[model samples]
Target chain A: MDALVIGTIIKVVLVLLIVSALAGFGTYIERKVLAFMQRRLGPTHVGPFGLLQIAADGIKLFTKEDIIPQHANKFIFSLAPVITAATAFIALSAVPLFPTFVIPESLPLIGGAIVPSVIADVNIGILFVLGMMAAGLYGPLLAGMAQANKWGILGSARTAVQFLSYEVVTGLSVLAPIMLVGSLSLIDFNSAQAGGIGSWIIWQQPVAFVLFLIAGFAETNRTPFDLLEHEAEIISGYVTEYSGLRWGMFFIGEYSNMFTVSILAAVIFCGGYGDLGFIPGSLALLLKVVFFFFLMLWVRASWPHIRPDQLMWLCWKVLMPLAVVNIVITGIVVMI
Target chain B: MFEQIAFYLFSFLTIGLFLVTVFSNNILYAMTSLAAGMVLIAGFFFLNGADFLGVVQIIVYVGAVMALYAFGMMFFNVTKVVKEKNTSNLLVLFLGVSIALLMVIMFLSPIVPEAIFASVPPEPNATNPEAVGMVLFSKYLVPFEVSAVMLLIAMIGGIILAGKKMDQSLTKIEDEIISEKDVK
Candidate 1:
């Protein structure tokens, strides 16, 4: 009993630490990418390679004055960022970092340790991730509504609609992979991609992979789908009233979500940490993650934000139909 | 023992969130509460024997359906005031409570044999993935196909709703633009 309790605690801490680091780096990468695309230098002043930029920003946010609009619901405003960051962190628990690297000493620290890669390894890991992602929207939605600002409300509404549309595509696209693998556990999904490069599910289900990527980008509120924060219209959207650490949490949550989606894309399509039998195990996983991170940065730099109606149309009309077809095809192929 | 405690805790949370969902005045709050309830229900499903069902419930209902409902609320310009409680439905609330009680009684009466519960099922061989595939294709093919059709219908319905509204708004704008052009 003691062992299990300690183990779970360690797992929770580990997850938080990893998520924070990823979120920080994600911010740095986004700024660099955006600057490069616009032909300008990005945050080069903070530290070497601007590596400490996020850290400096974090410190600044923490030290800055927290001002609440007199009319805002203080309780809900405070709760929003907590809910957002918490949900993002919770979703990462089910994602396996490496197939065998479970929380160290989580199971008694004995020799020949069971390298459990995930926190829970629940049977319905995919579902859990999706649920958390849905729950995650409350942060922005509540912040918008509670702030009693028109811009906040508009941003909140746009975000709500955008997420709803993409979520369908995300779920359906995931179904194609789930149907092929016949298991919902991330571990099971990763292991099934065991053979050489050809065995990767991405090659087998390219359409599903593409749909998943597009839907993931939309789900994370990345560029080409970020009408919620269109400066010309809603002016910073849901976080308009937030300042200091409170606002920082929202940005951190966004970056963490970017990492989460990228990691998920890697796991579902890029043979998740699999070395293709050439590179070593842990290194292979790291490479995959880095590769995905770059892909996300590349896409961010290249695409312009789509209009709100166009975004919805693309999700419902284009991605949804394609995802359904992918599922049908995967089911047939798997059966054969 | 720990599992039992965790199960009860999550079950209570699920019920509490469900109550919040029904009682909350704000539509967005109600949807958020519903999402929480769905997640806790997924926990309940995990505690019970239905692993896949639990996951699907979270993915489908919480992830997709509830999200869509929240989006609908936002798109339709629903505010907290719009979701205010209807005081005219006392009898309906009574009926709802009674129906819920009836369902609890109806479903909780069956007890699985103790012998089955006492023994953990041996871990099936990894090859069972193939067996699952075979069974799904051969036995569950009809339901599988039906689910596909159902999803297709839902997709088409959403598209019609969103698309039609968008086109109407666009045409209205186009008409104004054309009128201005003629005047110019």
Candidate 2:
């Protein structure tokens, strides 16, 4: 019992550290990618190649003044960022980072079980992630409403609607993969795709993969689906009223979610951490991670934000039916 | 024993959140409370040896349904709406409490006679998807088909309701443009 408690704590801490670092690096990468696209140096001022730029930004956010609007709901305002960052962090616990690195034992204390490589390889890991993502909407929604600003409310409204609409497609898209693997545990799903490139799920369920990717972008509030914070209209959206570390939490939460979705896409379709004999598995995993991260940046740089109606139409009219078809096809293939 | 403990814990959490959902004045707070409650209900399903159902509950209820509720609340102009009161009659509340107590007593009265204190054993290989699929497709096929149809209808309904408003606004814009052209 004591060991289990300690292991859970350790796992939580490790996950937090890894996710925070990923978020920081993701921010750095986004800046560099955007800069490169715009033909300029991104961040040459902080450290070597601006690597420490994230750390410097962290320091600035932490040391900066924290402000609360006069008419804001103080309690909900304080809680919003906490909910956002915390939900994003918790979702990582269920994601299998590597194929074989899961903490094996069901007990909390034993950090290294010979089992799969995840924090808690729960039987319903996928559901847990979905639940966490669902809970994640609260932070922005609450933050926007509590701010008493019209822009914040509008931003929050857009985010809520956009997320809810895309979530259906996300759920349906994942169902095809789940049905094919016959398991809800992400670790099991990853293992089922163990063979190199040929065994990747994307080959079999290309439509589902595409749908999941698009829904994921929407879920993470990335550009091309970022109607929530359309700068030409609502400045900073739900984050308009936040400043200092509070705002930083929302920013970090966004990056972390982006990383989470990329990692998920890697795991689900890109043969997570799988090496096709060209490089070591760990290196392959890192390459995949970096590749997906760059892909996100590329999309951000290349695509323009979709209008709200277009975003909704893409989900309902385009992705939803396709996801349903993917699931039926997978079912038939499995039976055959 | 652990499962029993987990069941009770999840039940308590679910009930607590449900109460908060009912009592909270703010729609957002109520929705959050309801989401938390639904998640705990999923936990309860897990304890009941329904792993697949538990996951589905979490994914569909807490993920999709609750998100819709929260988004609806955010978009609707509910700032000036007053909170509703708990207006059940005293006699009705008393009757409800008494009836619940009586049902609990009656259910436990028979079980008490058997001295059933042993922990319920976990089902072997209960996590296998094949078993779940077989039962779901064979025994529950009718209900399953019904649910699929219902969901399809709901999807169509959502699209119509949400899209119609946008269509109206677009038509209004077109009409205004045509009127401006005529004036010019």
Candidate 1's residue-wise lDDT over B21-80, tens digit each?
A: 787666655666676777677777667656666666766665454455555545644343
Mark the regions of model 2 whose C-alpha exceeds 4 Å error after superposition: A1-5, A101-115, B1-12, B47-49, B63-123, B128-131, B153-172, B175-184
Clashes of 2: 8
lDDT of 2 by residue, A159-206 (tens): 767876898898899889888887787777777888878899999889
Against the unseen true structure, what C-alpha lDDT does each candidate score? 0.76, 0.78
Model 1, span A108-188: residue lDDT tens: 555444557777777667767876777787788778877878898888778777877888788888888888787877777
The iRMS of the candidates, in order, is 4.3, 3.1
Query: For candidate 2 chain B, which ten residues in a row score worst on lDDT?
Result: B74-83
Provide DockQ values for all models, in the order shown: 0.28, 0.35
Angstrom error at residue B18, model 1: 3.7
User: Of the candidates shown, which would achieve the greatest TM-score relative to the real structure?
Assistant: 2
**Every model's Cα RMSD, please?**
4.9, 4.7
